[model samples]
Target: MAHIIMIHGSWSGGWMWDRVIPILTAAGHSAEAPTLLGADPGGSRFPSRPLTAWADQIAARVREAKGPVVLVGQSRGGLVISEVAERVPERVGYLVYAGAFLLPDGASLGGTIQSAHPGAEPIFSVDTATGMTTVLPEALERIYSKTPVRWIEYARAMQCLEPLAAITTPISVSDERFGSVPRAYIEATEDQVMPLSLQRAMQARLPCNPVFAIESDHVLPSSAPEELARHLVEIANRVDHPARLRRPVL
Candidate 1:
């Protein structure tokens, strides 16, 4: 069994993975879902941190986990996992990107998102003075298109403002570090937030083995929890033999 470290996207906390965590535990894998700095609405106020520092928080968890460690990131959390793998590649057994921004080294999430949809209206409203950002209400429908209405209300109530610095910070990784780790991608096929074409482009730029696809929107955890958990368990089952194929394929 592997210890899975689940990282949530912007405006979301560790609680975002609540739907999928129990299934992973029932499958015999342990899971740790941590809220990134400055993203917890109900917790103590925290100073905004750069993307790398956010990654360091997860890396610290990896150091404490026993057995194999699998790092999974959703949406903006993808950048967090990338940097963690760079800092502690030997400890991380695998990396999973679930409807996430699997950016290449030196890319920032803000830049990638803008480039992905040129001339498109902004999806977020940034408060420059406070250095925080919140999703525009009109864009909510696209983000949670496949999510059930029952969960959508609760999710929006819990959603919090995310730090802008984390989105604008660029990441740097070495081949000997993050590149040495085995990785996989869980494509949300119908994702409008990070559309399928953009997902494919990222995988092409930074290839990972055993690409798996799911027919869900951006928030797969809430919309397709069972399927998400099943894929995660499948990855856990292959922990011992995950690195044999480095090229991503169906």
Candidate 2:
């Protein structure tokens, strides 16, 4: 079984993976889902820190794995994985992006979103004293058509957003490190935050043709856990034995 590390995006924490973790573990794979820094919305004890600091935390998790891990990033966690891969590509076998950011060189989270669709509100807002940005309720409400009541409660619980300044800074990536690593992109067909066209466009930048489409919304793990689990397991199995090709033959 592959060791998988799951990273949550802005305004969310490790709790976001609660539904999927059981599935992965029951299937015999060891899985970890860590909340990013400044994203503990529920009064959890998370040290307020920068994006790079969060990347470092993930790298530490990767280092503790038994073997090379399958790093999975959701939403802005995509940016976290990109940075982690650069730091420890040897420890990462496959980078699985679930409706996450797959940015070009020298792009920040803010810049990437702005470049594609301008005048959008930042994914999060800040707490001046803590310098932590929490997710804006209005944004979440707008993104989800009928977000579960529990999720809204969770959002209320752990609602810190990333600071705009940190989000706008270009993340450092070396082509030498990120170029050779295998990549998988799970594009959400009905995603409101990330347009399908943009996901397709990002595919062009990956090293290999990623798993292109998953019929769901931005919140795949929550909205369609079983279907998402199937795709994730398939990708894990494919990485284990590259010779055993699973892509549908047209």
Candidate 3:
């Protein structure tokens, strides 16, 4: 059994991992989903908090874990986990990026997204005054279109503003530390929020072994919870018990 940490992306909290957490727990693995600072609802908002703060929050969680953890990050949370792995690589068993931004050193999330879509901003609504960004209601349709309507509603209700600085700040990860850790990437072929082409492009730059593809939207946790959970378990099993690596992929 491996300790798993689920880190959600921008405008989302630990609640996003609700489905997968139960599945992992049932399998007798320890799993935790931590809401990144400023992403939690009904809490103090700090728009100026840098991306390093988000990474530090996760690193702290990793430090508290019983053993090396399988860190799974979705969307913008990928950046946070990447930094966490860099800060405490010894504590991370594997770094999994599920339809996430696996950026290289010295890259910023905002710049990468801007480059991918150019002038087309499909989901985010930035508030310059508060230096925060929130997801547009209409974008929910794009994000969780494959998910049930009730799940979509729940996600919309839980949405919160994310600090703009967290996305704008570039991160520095060393090859000596972050690179030494094993990594995996899950490609959401039908993702609307982050285009499939962009997802493939990011993975091309930071290649991960045993890349898995799923026919789901950006919100895999809600859209394909069982499938996502199975994939995570497969990765964990392969990492923890090498004998399972030879098992046929489902």
Candidate 4:
């Protein structure tokens, strides 16, 4: 069974995957959802950290796993997984991007989002003093567009400020390393935070095999946990890790 590492994006913590993890475990796959350095509720207690720190945190997990593990990144966590694969490719069995930023080398999340929604008002307001970016509580409406009211409220309560430095940090990956690892994508079709057009654009550019689409918003954990869990398991079932690859059996 594949051990799935679930990385949360901006303003979110490991708690985001609480609903999804149990289902994954029930299906006989182990899962981990880690809160980024500055994305936890007590995140503000510490100073803002850099992208390498986040990538380092995950790479350690990959190295410590019993075998090569699947890296499943959601939202900005995609970059972290990509960086991890680049650094320790052999330790990574598969890479899965869920409603995430699948940017090429040298692309920063902030720049891509800015470029995508050109001339639009900023979704996050920056705290120049602390290098933190916070979403207006109201913006949860757009980010979790299709989610129920209770989930949104939970998200609002759990969400914290994200580090500006992390989003602005451009990733460095190479074909020989990061590219060698097998990868897939899970598209959140109705995402307002990262629009469907942008999702398709990234898929076209990067081109992951066996792209899976979900009719949900950006926050799939809250909106479509079971569906997301199913797709993840299906993707995990396909990769054999350093051995011959096997196509998913139905």
For residues 73-192, write the lDDT of model 4, one tens digit per residue. 889889989999899988887889999998889999989988988876566889888777888866888888999899999988886877788788888998888888777889999998
Expressed as tens digits, the lDDT of each residue in 1-250 for candidate 3 is: 8899999988888999998999998887889998877666768665365577878888988898896589999998888888998999888888999988898999999899888898775687888997778888888898887989999989888888877787788978988888877888898889987888998888778778778999999978988999999999888876677454332111
TM-score ranking of the models: 1, 3, 4, 2
Per-residue CA lDDT of model 1 for 1-250, tens digit only, reads 8999999998888988999999999999999799887677766555656586688888999999998898999999899898999999889888999999888788999899889897767768999898888888888788889999878887888888877887898878877788888779999999988889999999898887768999998988988999999999888777746554353331
Worst 10 residues of 2 by lDDT: 241-250
Predictions in order: lDDT: 0.86, 0.73, 0.84, 0.83
Model 4 lDDT at residue 175: 80
RMSD values, in order shown? 2.1, 3.6, 3.2, 3.0
Model 1, residue pairs in steric clash:
none
User: What TM-score does candidate 2 reach?
Assistant: 0.86
Q: TM-scores, in order shown?
A: 0.94, 0.86, 0.93, 0.93
Q: After superposition, how far is residue 21 of candidate 3 from its true place, in Å?
A: 0.8
Local error of candidate 1 at 66, Å?
0.4
Task: Name every residue pair that clashes in candidate 2.
Answer: 40-158, 41-157, 41-158, 41-159, 42-157, 42-158, 133-160, 133-161, 134-160, 134-161
Task: Return the top candidate by lDDT.
Answer: 1
Backbone clash pairs for candidate 3 read: none
The prediction achieving the highest TM-score against the true structure is 1
lDDT of 3: 0.84
**lDDT (Cα, tens digit) per residue for candidate 2, span 1-250:** 7898998876667887888888887877788887766565455445434667888989999999996588888888888898898999887878888988887668887777777889755545667886556666667754553357676566566555556555666777777776556788888888878877777777766533457677666767766677777777877776667665333211
